[model samples]
Target: MSGTILDRILEKKKDEVRKLKEQFDAGNESKFQKIPFYDSFIHADKMNIIAEVKRASPSKGNINLDVNPAKQAKHYEASGANAISVLTDEPFFKGTLADLKAVRDVVGLPILCKDFIIDPIQIDAAKQAGANVILLIAAALDDEKLKSLYEYAYRQDLEVLLEVHNEEEMERALVLNPSVIGVNNRNLKTFEVDLGVTERLLSRFGKNHDRIFISESGIKTAKDVERVQKAGAKAILVGETLMLADDIQLTMNQLKVRLR
Candidate 1:
C-alpha cells in the first residue's frame, strides 16, 4: 500500500472516532448490555465465526459499501454467528458506530465494536454504541495504556480481545491478560497475510495462555477454519471473506457447521 493511502485512511479514522465520541457523550447511541461473547460457542453449539459488517479497507477499497447494517445483521444472526463485528472506523473502512447501533436494534447477538481504540473516551463510545466486546491491537499501545484500557473495559463488563500479530505483540498482550487473545495472521507493517502466523503463536504459547485463543485474518475456507481449530482456537475473526459473499448467512452457517 502507498504511504498516501495509509495516511489518508488513518486521518479519516481519527476524525470519525472524534465525532463518534462526541455523539456518544450526547447520549444518542445504543447501549446493548449482554455478554454473549464469553460463552458464544457454547450458546450457539458451534465454533464462532464473528461475522463483520464493513464496507471498505485500506488494502481493499469499497467492498460492500452500500450494504444495509440492519438487514445484514439479521442475516448474520440467522446464519448462526456467535457474535457480530462492526467496523466502526469510517475513513478507510466506510463504517460507523451508527451502523453498530443499527445492527444492535436488528439483532440479539453481541456486537464487537471494531475500531482503532486509543482512549477511554473511545471505550465509552463503544459501550454507548452497544458493544459487548472491544478489540485492542497490541502494536498500537504501550504496557501502561494497555493495562489501563483492559481494566477499564473489564470494569464496564466488556470482553476485551487483545490482538497480537507476532511474538513481541503476543508478549505485550500477555501482560494485559485480556479475557481473549487473538492471533492475527496479517502483518501490520506490510499487510501481507500468512496463516502460519497463527501456527507459530499457538506452537509457542497457546498451551500456556489462560485466556481464550482466537485466530484472526487470512482464513478463506472451511479447510482454513479446521486448520486453526486443531491449534486450540475455538473462535475466529473473519471480515473481508464473509463481507464479500453473496449470502453471508449461508457462509457463516457453513463455517460454524464445518468448524463444529
Candidate 2:
C-alpha cells in the first residue's frame, strides 16, 4: 500500500514538473526584482487569509479558468486578505506563471505560489513569477529535501509555509523550522477532513515554538472560522468555499468578522 502511494505521488510530481517547465518557458514571468512581501504579511491585523487563484483541481476539475487573475486579486485585497496563493501548475490545475504574475502586479498583499512544488527549477520559477511565499508539503518531500527547499525559499527572500496532515508528518515539518506551519485538515490518503487535526497538533507545538500556526481546508462558513480560531490557529487558508461565494469580498468579510 505504501508503495502504491509512493508511485502515485511520484507520477503526479513528474507531471507537475513537466508542466512547471512549460510555464517557465512561456515568457510571461514577473519583470520586477521580486518585492519583499513577507514583511507585509507579518504586519496584518487579523488572521492572515491567503486567498488562492487557480483554474481547477484534479479532484474537482475546471474551476473558473476564465476568471481574470488581476480582478480576483483586487477583490481579495479589498476584502482584507493578507496574502494571495496562485496555482501555476498547468496540467491538472490549468494555471500558469501568468496567473501568479498577474496577481503580483495588481495586489499589494503578499502572494503565495501554490503548486506541487517538487524541484528547485519550480522554486526559481516561483521567484521569477513573483511569489513571496512557497509551500512545502511534508507528505511529498523527505526531510533533506524539505530542508533544501525551505532554505532555498528563504535565501530568495521568500517565506516558507510547511504543510502537514498528521503527527508524523508534523514531526518532519518541525525539523525544517519553517517560518509558518500549516496543519491541513484534509487527509491526502482518503481526502477525509476534520478540524480536530489542528487541535490535536496544537498540543505538540507547545507555547514557545514561535512558528505561526495556520489551519487549512474544510473551512466553509463564518462559524467554521470561529471554531478554528478558538482552537488556536493564527490563520486559515480557504479555497473552494470562498471561490464559490456569490460575492467574494462579502465572503471574505464574513470570515474576517468571525476571526475577530
Candidate 3:
C-alpha cells in the first residue's frame, strides 16, 4: 500500500511461494491432467469470455467475500464462459488454492490459476490445484526467469497466459511465443485501468495475430466488450463487474458480444 502496489504484492508473493514450496514438499503432489484452455478458443468462432473467480484485489478491495467459488464457476460455465480464471493469491486477492480446487471439481471448462507467479514451485502448485493454465506476468519476471518458467510449465503440460502491460513487456512475452497473450489494461504498479491499452498493443498484431489475444482488466459493459473485440481481442478476462453484479449470469449474458 505504501510503495508501488505491484512491488508490495511481489514481496509478499516471494514469501508465499517459499511457504507453498514447503507445503508441497511435505505433501504429495496431486496426479492431475491438463485441461484444454487454448483449444476451446481455437475451435470457437466468436469472442470468448474467461470469467474470473476473484474475491478481492489490491486495487478494488473486497468485491465479494461470501460467494462460493464452486457455485460461481458453475454459473460462469452455464453462462457460456469459455474458461475460468481462479485467483489463488491469498493476501491481496483473498483467494487460495482451495478455491481453485473447488472450482475445478465443479466446472468442466478449463481453469486458469491467476496469481503473481514468480517461481517454478507455484506452477507445480497450480497443477496440483487443478489448473489447466497459469498466469505469467511479463513485468514481474526477467527474460531468463520468464523463459525458464514458461518452459517449465509446458513440461508439466500446463498452458501459460503470458500477461503484458506495455510494448516492452509484449516484446519480451512474444519471445517465448506463448500460447496465450493477455494485454492487461490495468497497470500492476499504479493500478490504473485503460481499455485502450489492449487496443494499442494488439493493433501492432493487426487482424491476423496468431496467438490467442485476451484483453484483461477494466472491462465493464457490453460496449467495453464490443470495443476490445473490434480491436482484435479474441478473448476477455472479466472479474470485478460480474462479481459485483445483481445477477452474475445475467450480467455475463448482457456483456457477451460476438465478432466474426
Candidate with best lDDT: 3
Provide C-alpha RMSD values for all models, in order: 2.8, 2.9, 1.6
Q: Who is ahead in lDDT, 2 or 3?
A: 3
TM-score (all chains, Cα) for each model: 0.89, 0.87, 0.95
lDDT for 47 (candidate 2): 66
Error of 1 at 27 (Å): 5.7
Candidate 3 lDDT at 50 equals 93
Global CA lDDT computed for model 2: 0.76
User: Once superposed on the true structure, which residue ranges of model 2 sit more than 4 Å away at CA?
Assistant: 1-9, 15-38, 41-45, 258-260
For model 2 the TM-score comes to 0.87
Best by TM-score: 3
Q: Please give, for residues 15-112, the per-residue lDDT of candidate 1 as tens digits.
A: 76676566555455445667668676533345677888988876777888898988887888787777889998876688887899899888888789
After superposition, candidate 3 runs with Cα above 4 Å error: none
Worst 10 residues of 3 by lDDT: 25-34
Model 2, residue 130: what's the lDDT? 82
How much lDDT does each candidate structure score? 0.79, 0.76, 0.88
Descending-lDDT candidate ranking? 3, 1, 2
lDDT of 3 by residue, 90-209 (tens): 999999999999998888888999999899999988888889999999988999999999999999889999999999999888887776899999999899999999999988854555
